[model samples]
Target: MKSYDDKHIKNIVLVGAPKSGKTTLSETMLFEAGIISKRGTIEEKNTVSDYHEIELERGNSVYATLLHTEWKDYKINIIDTPGLEDFIGEVIAAIRVADTAVVLLNAQYGVEVSTEILWEYIDRYRKPTILAVNQLDTELASFTKAVEDARRAFGNNVTLMQYPVNQGPGFNAIIDLLKMTMYRFPKDGGKPEKLPIPEEEREKAEQLHNELVEKAAENDDTLMELYFEKGSLDEDELREGIQKGMLQHQVFPVFCLSARNNMGSGRLMGFIDNVAPAAIDVPAEHTADGKEVAIDPAGPTGIFVFKTLVEPHIGRLSFFKVIAGEVKAGMELTNFANNTTERISQLFIADGKNRNTADRLRAGDIGCTLKLKNTRTNDTLGDKHFPGPIAALEFPSPKVRVAVEPQNKGDDEKLSEVLAEIHLEDPTLLVEFNRELKQVILHGQGELHLLVTKWRLENIYKMPVVFLPARIPYRETIQKPAQASYRHKKQSGGAGQFGEVYLAIEPWYDGMPPYKDHPVRDSEEITLSWGGKLVFNNCIVGGAIDSRFLPAILKGVMEKMQEGPLTGSYVRDIRVSVYDGKMHPVDSNEISFKIAGMMAFRDAFHQAAPQLLEPVYDLEATAPDTMMGDIMSELQSHRSIITGMDAANGNQVIKARIPQAEIDKLFAALRNVTQGKAKIKAEFADYAPVPADLQKKLSENYKETVAV
Candidate 1:
């Protein structure tokens, strides 16, 4: 293999909805470039992109695969990403590093739910994009409708660069508007033969060609002036103008292809090689501290790790893009994240499951290295003398959660270790061990995402796992003030334990004094270990109970707050004052005071109006207008309060606040109600009081569980 400079490199990512033929397109590209001898299909379960066992079993991509090919002297690194919403993290990581994205659309379906969702990220990264309308050979394929849908969804910037000459079963040719030529492919569909446009189709081709020329000229002042004078742009001028327009996002050229049959792919590859932007062409990356790092071969050595894969028998493989200078074998770089040095033993270019060893990776090139001590995904490695850490990639929060436990009961430790390893590969899968709930919760994107995780745990880790309904984190608080007293006396063996305490409890609020009548005197406000605040006022004048014993009493009060008297949930927002107490000199120890404080706090809490509060989440659902009514009705039935609604991108955005308990299986429900056309995002808002009847039921259930 020869080393290419940054100018000869092109980084591209293939993204779209599931069944959009991304993997098939990737296979065709590799075959046309001579990187693979034969193209493979998803049905055969032999495609290079979807190589994982789980992916093969499901016939869908679950992870992003990296592969490279050389076309017309340009090295194109293609990152094939998963289109399912469950694995959106893979798409996000690929788009973050690539200079261009080729968003594929199903010719029959046009813009789909997943396509709309992915378009948002593509716009966020501002990557120069080319839209490829695939499956043009299918019976239901409609090129004009797909183009119109693209225009409507992405605005008028979408201009047709190519269209099938004879679509459907006989789709073996395409008219290239930019080149003003016809690309005729053989029945088997490998290499294309260039020919002049047929006389019958020349009229429409000429019109589209002129439209393409005008769209290109509008992006640049020089091109616009030249077009006005000459009434057209020559071949060279048109290509230059289109490239410039693409980089500025002023023009989004659409192409036609049947990736399964390998028709029109060679021409598309040529367009990418000649027109797509390179890494250096992209805007410079910025560090977390707002420092710009340019892609210069002579600058400091910097490689940003975008993805990590754990290969069997080979350890961790860190896939990175060299942003500054070049990285060679045996070079040592500092991992800025952990402030540790890692020696690069070898560098290799990835091709699906195989790897081609490279002596060195130049700037703007992507490669993988094995066995780094501290480097992980989103970490930056740079020369020690020029240490600049790039900001990490921002992933969406997990939307679905399930309580997971080991089926064998003794595999708890093994389960934790395996989950930690999986988290390293996919950060979107969050594993949380809640001590209060006494459950290990696994949070992910959707049901399919967690299902795949469960399969991995059972098959790869040899540990059977079960997912249970997650417990809600409810809180306990008081609504009114109350007073109580308790005495602790225990006469064991030698010395007696005796202490008496009288305390007043009230609901704490901001700007409220310790008491109504008593003046401020030695009051302490401390944050509870769990949450909320604890205001303890020591009104013990003349040393009724020793000042040293005040902390001991407060300790006991905190202990009771941890496990509320009404329910076992943690308590919050309350104040206690020990105005009077009795103590025996012989038995007035810390234990005696602690016991008395705990008993008095418990009695006062029962007297006060105790209430239960459940966590609420701000919910946002995006769906088609037809399904908005159904979604809103379903939310209302779950005790949700609709806050606002708006229209966006031909869809309705419904915002509401709903209790966490109501959303245990919300993702599945929303998918069912909208026929998988709606998406949702949820985040914790605040705790609100539960309904009186529901609160009583929860209290009873908690008592029963505690008793059992």
Candidate 2:
């Protein structure tokens, strides 16, 4: 294996919407570089990037695949990410380690909804990006419209680097702006023959070329001065200017491509090798403690594991990037997170399912190894002298949730192991077994995301599972104050048990005034684990209740709070004052007091008008303006409170707050209303009181459950 420094390595992540030809382009790149003898199409199910069974079945990329092509003394590591929004976690992992992003656009549809959402992440990181308008050979492929869409979504920095000479159907040539030449490819599309620009296209080519030069020169003062003096820039100067512009996010160079036919991929690779930023060229990585780790092979040996894949027979494969130094096969590195030393038995570069063994991988290079002990997705393994932990990758919060259970019921333990492995691979899918609800909830990016998880559970793990509606984590609390008393007595036993408790229950709120009618002798405000607070006050007058018996009384009240009186939900935000009680000296034990307190609190809760509060979430949905009215109407019917609306990139962005129970309904309606073009993101806000009718129905349901 040949070792290249950080400067000779380029980590390029292929990202776009579905049918943008990312997988096909990946195959073409490998074939062009002679790594593969021939290209494989999606229909053939033999493409190197889409090697997974699930991907081949779906005929699309599902997970982020890692493939490298050694081209022109530079090793370009291409990470082909899924175009579906449900598998966004895969895209996020790929982008974090990538130095440059090649965002492909299907010229037929221009910019898609999924691609726009992914672009937000790329723009947020300010990564050096290249826009490849692929599939120019397809029918209705308009390069002008795609470029227009790019400028609208990505600002004026969308600079045109090449224009298709014959875009639709017979797209065989592209006019290069920087080279001032034309690349005419043969029918097969491997290598292109350099030719002069046709006279008919000379005017448009020169105009776009001048515009590209101006956009590039805006990034650096030196480039600006040179451009003004010479009225144009040479090839080297233009490349330098574009590199600087990409680093600063001042330019997104657009290239014409028909990745299916392999017309312009060779030139695209050449540009990536020369203009794309390498790890050495990108900004230094920051540690958790705010220290910078420069990309240098001579520094401490450090590798950060950004992804983990667990196969049935292969166990776990840890994919990592060498951040600061090189790691050989026999090297021993310590996991900075857990302080455990790990031995590098073997290092291998990955190409989908294929693994090519290598002696070592240098800084900024990505590779994978098997049989790592106690290493996870985000752990940083390095030499013992390496300073500290690297910054962990941030994943988006889950927006959709569903209850899941194994079909066999006996496979519960195995299902747990499967869910754990799933979470290890995709952090966005959260698995939680709710103790109160008695259900296992899987929270994910969307409905499709959960469906994919279910498919995996049934197929890969062989644990057939069924998905149910996730129960809302409702809370119970009183709306008004009420008083009740209870007496617990048992005469059958020797030393009869007898105790009585009198207490007042009222709603609790922040910074509320204390009760003054009976002095609050002592108050302990407790924060409930389920949210909200419970303030227990000991207000005994004339020794009505002994000081020693207060704990017993509080314990009973807490039991009632755990299984709330109204709807059997966790009670929150209520104050309880023990004003008076009676106890028999001979039989007044903790058990007697506990029973009395619980009965009394339950009795008072019914009189105090308890209300059930369901969890609510803040949601923001984006869709084209043509479908905004239909989406808004559907949302309004689901009790969504439309907070605001705005226009972004010629689309409507709707913001609303909705109860958790109605979330599924809103999205189901959106799919039909918008034809699956709407994108939504939701997060937990705060719990609010359910509607009056809903509270009554829920309370009645709890009563029926208790009776049964």
Candidate 3:
């Protein structure tokens, strides 16, 4: 493979909803660029972008794939990403590094739920984008409606660069607005012949062409003056102005395509080569200290790993973009993450599983290197003397959780090791061993995401795994006040343990007075690790209890707080006033005071109207308005409080406060009800009291466990 300079590179990520023909479009682009001799389809499970075993079985792209093709002087690196929301992490990572985002909209569905979800990230990064309305040959395809949907959802900047002359079954021609020429393709659809606009479509084409000329000229005053003087801009002038608009993120040109038939991919690739912005044309990247750094080929060697793939037998492949300078095969670079040196032993420009060995890759180009010791996603590798380690990529929190366990108890260690490797490959999948719940929790985007992990374990790792419902981390707190005293007496012949404690318990709240009922000698406010506060007040006077025993008393109280009296959950937000107590200097050691404090707190807790609290999450569900009833019903069933509702791109944005216990169920339910058209995001709000009935049932279950 030949090396391409930074100016000749264009990195574009394919993004769309499922069935939008992104994989097919990628295959057509590769075939058009002559990188692939023949085109493949998702139905045949043979496309380079969707080459994973899991993807072959599912017949869609599951991972983001990096493939390069040379068009004229440009080396276009295409990252084909999955459209399903379950694999959003892959799409996000690809968009983070892509210079241009080619957003494909299915002509059948226009802008879909999944596309709306992806548009947020693209808009956030402010990438130069080109919207391609694909699958125009399908029966239900409506090109006009698709353009309207694009303009409405994306913005008015969606310029119509091309439109199909005859859509539906006989779609074989497109009118290019910039060139003012008609592209007539053969029945097989490649290398279209240029022709004059037909008389019937001439007026509309001329009006749209004028609009395109003005849109192109609006970005630059020189282009505007040229447009005014000549009444129109030529192809070269239009390209310069459009490229300027794209670099400013002020224009999103729209094009027509039938990727399955390979109708318009050649023209699309031509525009990407001629008009898309390169790395240096975009904004400078901000460092960890918020310093802007330009992409300098002559500056220093820098490569940032953006994605990691672990094959069954091929080991780990680190995919990275050359940020500055050039990296040659066999060169050594220091890992900014761990300060260790890693040799760039084997470099390849990979398309799917296939590799084209490369001698060196320059700045703004993406390629893969195999077998790095301490490199992973978000890590940077550069020259030893160069400052590097770019800011890390931010991933969304998991929306679904499941408790996973091995079928064979002996495979627990192996399962942990396997899961750790999986996490390295994909950071969105979070794994944790909850000591309080005594369960190994696996958090991911949705059910399919977790099911894929299970499939990998069973098929690739050769391990049997079982998934169970994850336990909720509930809390216990009191609703009222009560008082109790305990006496600990232990006589073991040699020494006797005698201690008595009197304490008043009250429910704690923020900004409350410090117990007017008791005079305090000293106070200690403790912040519990389990998400609440604990306040202990010592009110003993006239040496009713030694001050030295207070620490031991607090320790015993903390131990009890760790396992609350009602349901063995963590207790939070309560105050204990130890106003009176008795202790023997010789017999009453720390142990005796500890025992007395534990029993007294427990006894008072039982009488103080203890309540159970469950975590609450602020959830926002976005979907089409047609599915509003089903969404409302699902939330209502989960006892969610619907806070408000808004409209986003013709879809409903429903916000509510729902219990954490119901969030996992809501995720699956929403997907099924909307047929995977709904997108949801949840963040922890505050903890609220559980329903009375649920509290009673939970208490009974805890009692049964204690008895057993």
**Candidate 2: misplaced stretches above 4 Å?**
516-520
**Model 3: colliding residue pairs:** none
Ranking according to TM-score, highest score first = 3, 2, 1
Q: Show model 3 residue runs off by greater than 4 Å.
A: none
lDDT of 2 at 214: 91
Query: Cα deviation of 108 in candidate 3 (Å)?
Result: 0.9
Please give each candidate's TM-score. 0.95, 0.96, 0.97
Instruction: Please report, as a residue range, the 10-residue window in candidate 1 with the lowest summed lDDT.
Output: 512-521
Clashes of each: 0, 0, 0
- The Cα local distance difference test for each model comes to 0.89, 0.91, 0.92
Task: Let me know the TM-score candidate 1 reaches against the reference structure.
Answer: 0.95
Q: Give the TM-score of candidate 2.
A: 0.96
Best by lDDT: 3
